[model samples]
Target: MDEALWAVGRGTGVAALVLFTASVVLGIITRSGRPLPGLPRFSVTLVHRNVSLAASLFLVVHVVTLMFDPYALLNLLDVFVPFFGSYRPVWQGLGTVAFDLLIVIVVTSLLRNRLGPRVFKAIHWLTYAMWPIALAHAIGNGTNGVEGWFLVLSGVCVLAVLASFGWRLSSRFVEFRSVRLGEIS
Candidate 1:
């Protein structure tokens, strides 16, 4: 039972990280207002939303499984509140912070229609911070943090987000410059 729970915790932790990376990348792509190659912008946005929800599910499983495992040094406070764990305080705290951010992002997103666009957009931007916090926690606390494949995966995830973000920023800058120069009116 213990081993099973531990395995579930480990597997879900990795899965959540992968899914979160996808969510971040997709989100950045979607926000760029560009259609994915061979796909419409709406489709890309839909996939991004679904992927974010799935990542949240995996993250919950990761936390719950660890809490259930006898060997895991996390309590409810540790899982819910940052830096409250008796275990590796800093690393675990990062995870807690990430989870808290995710909760705010998700909840606000769900209530987006009622809360209005400004509120939704404000909370949604937290994904940028949450993803890095989660990645740092995974690298610091993961059992396979130093493994070859894990490093490769992390590199890929980082590059995807950075590239997408770079494109978004550069495009916006170009648009601003164009407008300033009377090129776009």
Candidate 2:
């Protein structure tokens, strides 16, 4: 039972990270209002939403399994309150913080119609912070953090996010400049 729980916990953690990475990339594309080579803009947005939801599901399972695993030494409070765990409190706390932020992001998203665009976008920005915190938690607390395979995987995730983030910023800047030039004209 312990071994099963540990495997599930680790697997889900990795799955959640991958899914979150995809969600962030798709979100950037959605924000740019651009479609992939063969897909429509609406499809991109839909995939982003689905990917985010899937990541959330995996994250929940990861936490649950860890809580049950004796190796983790996590309790209910540790899951919700940051820095409350006996095992690597800071790293575990980061995971809790990320989870809390995710909950807020999800809730606001579900109420997007009621919350209005400004509010929704503001809350959505939390994803930028949450991703890194979750990554840190995975590395600092995960037993496989120093393993070559995990390190390589983490490197790839970091690179993907950095490239996508750069694109997002550049696209926004271009849009701003175009609008300014149009106004001047």
Candidate 3:
């Protein structure tokens, strides 16, 4: 049972991170306004949201299983409150902080109509912060952090995000230049 719980936690955590990486890349793709083949812009938004929800579920499973695992020594407070866990407090606390930011982003998104665009947009931007924080948490706390395969996986995820960021930056620059040259209104 203990081994099963540990494996489940580790598996779910990795799944969540991978899904999160996809979501971030897709979010950037959507923002860049580059229509994917056979995928409309709205579909991109829909897919990104769905992927994020799946990742959230996996993260919940990861946290719950770890909490139940005796080896983790984690309590309820440790799950929500940062820097108080007995095991690897710094890394664990970063996860806590990322979780808190995720809650804000999710809640705001759900209440977006009521909150209006500005607030929702502001909160949604936290994804940029959440991604790196979550990545650091995983790298610093993962069971297989030192493994060659895990490092390669982490590198791929980082590259995906960075590529999206670079593409988005260049696209924005082109748009700004177009505006300056009266090429676009």
lDDT of candidate 3 over 1-185, digit per residue (tens) = 99999999999989999999999998877665555799976788789889999999999999999999999877899989998998899999999999888989989989999999889978899999999998898989989876899889999999999988887777453333344467754
Off by over 4 Å in 3: 172-185
For residues 3-55, could you state the per-residue lDDT of candidate 1 as single tens digits? 99988998899899999989888887776555688898689989998998888
Clashing pairs in 1: none
lDDT of each: 0.85, 0.89, 0.87
Q: What is the C-alpha RMSD of each candidate to the true structure, in Å?
A: 3.5, 3.0, 3.1
Clashing pairs in 2: none
By TM-score, who's the top model here?
A: 2
TM-scores, one per candidate? 0.90, 0.92, 0.91
lDDT of 2 by residue, 58-148 (tens): 9999999998999998888998999989998998899999999999999999999999989998999999999999999889988887789
lDDT of 3: 0.87
Name the best candidate (by lDDT): 2
Worst 10 residues of 2 by lDDT: 171-180
How do all the candidates rank in terms of TM-score, highest first?
2, 3, 1
